[model samples]
Target: MSEKVSLLTARIIDNRRVAPAHFLMTVRLPLSFATPFPGQFVMIRNDECDGPLLARPLSVYGFQRQQDHAVMDLLYRVVGQGTSLFSRMIPGEELCFFGPLGKGFSIPTGVKKVLLVAGGVGVAPLIFLLHKRLLPADGKGIMETIFYLGARTAELLTGLERLCGFCDLKICTDDGSRGYHGPVTGLLKHDIGGFDAGDTVIYACGPKPMVRAMGNLLQDAPFHCQVSLEERMACGLGACLGCAVAVRTGEGKTDYRRVCQDGPVFDLRDIVFASPAGP
Candidate 1:
């Protein structure tokens, strides 16, 4: 069946702003909601009369199951007219959304260290990964997960305090208000030395510039890096051809791949960034 078959109306259980422009919405999905992997996203649209002509695609942050009800959480920022409309939605409102879409992060055996990188709202998928992997209810976590979260300012760093218990957390603010000033990459540089490159892997989700930097830094290193890309997508599937990512080939060639299908997550070395952040 088409992935869209997973489509169902999600009833809002709660929706509130976490920061000046960031919002978190808790919603209950139908029993048939597809199980989504870390790094996957959903296309959503609320029941509105006008504007926001198309659905806005968002990352699947986290989910829980209570009795027979399944609850999913969405973390979003008000950046445009579409997201602005999303912020206005309140509890008890229903929004049409579906997911478990796109390719997600992967872990091979013998990985002892998992490094996660997030900037701004990039915390969404990484948080889900922490729960479903490192902090699973069974408490059988094998790998040590570390997070390096960054934002422009302290006020822009979302959910830093609440997620500290899940993993080794490090915070960076560009304007020197948080744990470290400058880039999160600086923190990684300071800490990456402690990890064995061969046994370490990286997962990053953030702006193009940040993801691109990661690709450049670890491309030739022993670390296996996977990056979750952010794109403005029309359809949550490949049918729209709206979200294309540049991929690098062995023969000095670049291939355009669809982010909604080929991946929201991909091997860092495979990406050909527009402006290469060379190491």
Candidate 2:
């Protein structure tokens, strides 16, 4: 929550389908809105429509400041009623939004290598972290950056074109229709040994099963790792107490933290994953 949260109305600049069921919506905000950091999210809802009463949480896919305004991109899949309403939205439509809420990723000081792992639409924030914060103008940075992306098939993968110009990109598919056969984690497991663990850090986001598998896979690894958790939220603020997650505290005690406020991003080791796999 380093950035101040504000409730404002943004006009839709563009909203179009990027993949089969995924859509990328671009909105224009006033210059007074606070800039968002990578991994931060916004709660957005179309006030004029008869959709779900509560606003849905969406990750900030991209953001850029213009001379008089700021443009933001939100990438989402059409999964249910609320999103269906959003898909029908046209340009010039106004949407109510509250954000850049929750804690975001913090790159470790002097880290020599960075790894980003994403599944499905989760690539949104990771792509933002790469271009907006990680890569330099010369297309090189002090740290060696690599991105590992995975999806059910090639068609479901988003942000591949944008990622190629920024870092080393590795892709995988579950159906063997893309770069590597099997899960994206399989690729990471194969290449992880090449890096110095002490100088490396990993950031990830995806479905619950994928995230759980990632945690279990890297539990004993020496590299520092952080993950963004996807959870249902009511109030983007901490007031509702609906997005609480169990976590291991420093004292070895279990405690509850609100995902909406305490984090959307947290140390992978601190999270208590109840299931062996799956949500």
Candidate 3:
């Protein structure tokens, strides 16, 4: 985790609808603001509004530094009151935010292949990761990158333009309106045999069902898998115990971990998914 978490204000530069019910908001940040890693997020709220008391946790979609200030893009879906308000915000309006919070995805050494999986708006952080990996500051050799994207419908899929010409992009839509006619996980499962698990790493961010299904698919596999969880967070800091997840301890016991502070990212094998309740 980054040691510096600052409470700052950003001026909205653009807020445009990208997909149906999805908006891509661009904001300008202070030049001194620390850059956030992939899977890390920010807590934001309308500075002028008094409603929606708590700040909403949003993943960093895209980031770039300019001469005088930095720019960040936040990709969000209008699901409730907070995001509904965000959709109506215009340029020059300021938003209060605090973060670069939660742990992010870490790639291990000697990995030859990288697989990025995303579902719906969960593609936000994965896009950030893709940008960094494609244009790394360290000038390291690029790995074989493959991206699997899934959405409920073709209209709801965003970021396709940015993803093209960058990696091996595969897409799936639930309604057969896109590339594959099934879930993104199913696409990955079908193509996963091409790579050797020992030197491959998988990073995923999506809804619970998609993630859970991925977990089950790779539970006994040798590939290194990490998942970014989208849990409800009241406070970005550890003080609020709102985002807790269950994991297996070394002794095979179930223990709880905080998603806000400890991770939005975790080893896929470490998570313990609860069974669906009986009717």
Candidate 4:
């Protein structure tokens, strides 16, 4: 932590329901704080105490850094208490947060093609990546970016409207409410051929199962794939070690690594997804 952690006094800029079960909120961070990178998360507190137990970790959706002004956008789903509070925040209300925490998505320096995969709320972080890195310098980018977004319905898919300025986007909703009537991976399989395998990269963030599914889909592909891993977190820091993930090692073994510290973003090949036993 910095001696004086930049106390960003963020006000709820806009709170709107984008999907049946999803919401998007924009918060204006203090101008002094640095802009956050894609795949980075923020620890939000509904109240300044332990009552809420722990800060809810959320991916940074996108940010705007203007003359002495910084604003961060968040795409959240109301799945729990912390997020519920986030959904209810009024436009003028204030909230406390700590972040730009954890490592973020890595964009290849000379990559000629990029594929961004998003699942539900997982789309949050990718928005930041596309806006800052993929957009053209003079308002048009050098690389071709293809966005693959998946959801059950058109309403479940959020945030693509803004990305139209940067990439060629494709949508897939299971219920046939939007573009393609199938999983986003379906689009990847058909469209991925347009780019060179060696020169392309895939950055994904979403539910655990989807990440695993994506891993399976890209197993034989030559392109590099990185998936953002989500774990049940207590302390957004490494102190708790509650967010450990199993990683494959060079010795043909597996070891546990902290998700909060070692990564929130990881190379797809590094993770070992084991099946859970139960009913």
Off by over 4 Å in 1: 1-5, 138-140, 250-252, 275-279
Query: How do the residues 1-279 of candidate 2 rate in per-residue lDDT, one tens digit apiece?
Result: 456887999899999999998999999998888889899999999999876998999999999999999999999998888888998899999999988999988998879889999999999989988887788878786678899999999999999778986888999999989999988888898998888888899999888888888888888887798898888889989999888788898898778788888989989898898834422
Q: Which run of 10 residues does model 1 get worst, by summed lDDT?
A: 1-10
Instruction: State the weakest 10-residue window (summed lDDT) of model 4.
Output: 1-10
Writing each residue's lDDT as its tens digit, candidate 3 over 1-279 gives 577887999899999999989999999998788889889999999979987988999999988999999999999999999999999999999999887898988889998888999999999989899887644655443888888999999999999977887778899999989899989999988988887998999999999999999988897678899999988888989888888888877898877788988899999998989934311
Structural similarity to truth (TM-score) of each candidate: 0.92, 0.96, 0.95, 0.91
What pairs collide in candidate 3?
Answer: none
Q: What's the lDDT of the predicted structure labeled candidate 3?
A: 0.89
- Supply the global lDDT for candidate 1: 0.81
Give candidates' CA RMSD values in order. 2.9, 2.1, 2.4, 2.9
State the lDDT at 195 in candidate 2. 81
Which ten contiguous residues of candidate 3 have the minimum total lDDT? 132-141
Q: After superposition, how far is residue 252 of candidate 4 from its true place, in Å?
A: 2.4
For model 1, residues 96-197, the per-residue Cα lDDT tens digits are 877768887777788888898998899889888877766667654578888899998988888675477777888998899988997888777777768898
Tens digit of per-residue lDDT, candidate 4, span 1-279: 122235455778898888776888888777777667778787777664344667778888888887867888888898977787778778988777777778877877768888899888888888788887778668676787888889888878888787776687888988888999988887777776677777888999888878888888878877788888888788877788898888897898788888876789999988888735311
Q: What is model 2's C-alpha RMSD?
A: 2.1
In Å, residue 186's CA in model 2 sits off its true spot by: 1.5
TM-score of 1: 0.92
Please give the lDDT score for candidate 2: 0.89
What TM-score would candidate 3 get against the native?
0.95
